[model samples]
Target: MESPFWDMMGMLGIYAPLALGAIGSILGCSAGGQAACGAMLDVESGYGRLVGLSALPSSQTIYGIVVMLSLNRTIEIESAPGLFAIGSLCGVALLFSGWFQGKCCASAIHATKSKPEIFGLSAAPAAIVEGFAVFAFIFALILAGSLPAATGGV
Candidate 1:
């Protein structure tokens, strides 16, 4: 028989993606937003671009929401391990991706502040980070499909 701890773990797993992703987004956005605010002081224009760049990390939260929804079902002991593994790992991937993407955005913002010509190029690194987040999101959805659905009413 399964322990109550494992059952709780399954429940935790269901929500982990959304929680972790939001935390990551919060951290990432703060980092980029702070840099953008500083950049605003240094630059005369292009405020819109800086603001837009800072918002890029927010996508991770949306991805997290999707993953959470995909993983949602009545938790069963038999499926608990899979749920915990896939959900937690995907959440970690999203968390790091969002954090790093924000750092990239900050660097890009700083660089562009001094040299406006590189604005487009500076966003490349952030985009690359975003690509990785997308990979995690896609795989989580795929794996979530393999888990057994709720067998009866919760």
Candidate 2:
């Protein structure tokens, strides 16, 4: 029972993704709630597109989680430790991306609710949120791209 193995197990494993998922879900849900409420208030404005956009924030979070699982599928336990660190960092980015995206969506909805006259203006800020998601996705791809074949002999 070597301690290095245990230390590695604790540092660059499922814990990262689990934390990421939890953070993403909590923040994303809060943002979604705000967006949904705002959209609900603007029932007659035809800004229904915003309602759909509310879910966009969770895209990166979901993608991050999938990437983490996929990496586990592809990478063997014997691979370099650096891969794990990179993957963990990517997961963190994804979590933040989703949280912020949701925030933008919620703000957009709020804007629409307050002034149905400026739905277009509201969309601009929402795009910023999308930018973060894109950044997170690209980072995840970079981290996951270097993975080796699964050690479980998948």
Candidate 3:
């Protein structure tokens, strides 16, 4: 019989992606939102754009959700290691990407506040950070397919 500890680890692995991703998104959004609010005080007519830019980091949470769903399965001793490896690593990637993306968005917002002409260009760095998150998401999905399936009658 499998130990309870392995089962618990498997469960933690299953949920880690979503939990970490959400935490990252929260941090990213908070940073960007604060910048947006500060910029709003300085700018007169582009509050909408600033607010929208602040939301750029939220996509990492969505990627996390997709990864969590992809990794979802019955806990088994055979699958636990794979689950933990893929989910935790993917979650870490997402966490960093979201956090950095938010910082990028904040910089963009601050820069654009003074030079609205560069608004679109300023978003490029944030988009690049998002690309890294997508890479992690895709790799997680691909690797998740290789985990051993749970045995019936557990």
Candidate 4:
């Protein structure tokens, strides 16, 4: 590829993940904070468990990075431009997935704290959030398959 194209993609490759990571961090932190706040609702309740569950949302951030790296390796030059856009979509999904998961976990934490007896109900939100991560990862995997074979040899 031309210098500019590679240059731009190279820059994007780095910046895109960075941005997603930053967003995930912020959202995760917020989710933790919200969970903490929720715990306060019932200090005598599952304060520890609620906090731990709330923190679960932050896990997606690391997963996002892993997905990005995997996509980078999976996508070859043959696919080129098509893969680029799809990869970007996955990256974008990472950012939003973190946010959604965080929110859900936070809400779940709150619910748990308020109704410790119904922890299962509280866990539902986290499950919902997981759907987004699954979708993003599955799409990435599909897109990787669609990528054109690498040109020449490795």
lDDT value, candidate 1, whole model:
0.90
Could you give candidate 1's per-residue lDDT for residues 1-154 as a string of tens digits? 2589878888788888888888889889999999999999988999999999998999999999999988888778888888899889889988999999999999999999999999999999999999999999999999998888767624
Query: lDDT per residue, candidate 3, 7-120, as tens digits?
Result: 887777778889889888998999999999999999889899999999998998899899898888888888988888899888989898989889999999999999999999
The number of clashing residue pairs in each candidate reads 0, 1, 0, 0
Model 3 backbone overlap count: 0
Q: What is the TM-score of each candidate against the true structure?
A: 0.95, 0.70, 0.95, 0.76
Model 4, position 45: C-alpha lDDT score: 49
**Per-candidate alpha-carbon RMSD to the true structure:** 1.6, 3.6, 1.8, 3.3
Error of 2 at 97 (Å): 1.4
**Deviating ranges (above 4 Å) for candidate 3:** 152-154
Note the residue pairs that clash in candidate 3.
Answer: none
Clashes of 1: 0
Worst 10 residues of 3 by lDDT: 145-154
Superposed model 1: Cα runs more than 4 Å off: 152-154
Residue-level lDDT for 92 in candidate 4: 75
Candidate 3 lDDT (Cα, 0 to 1): 0.90
Residue 140, candidate 4: Cα error in Å is 0.1
Clashing pairs in 4: none
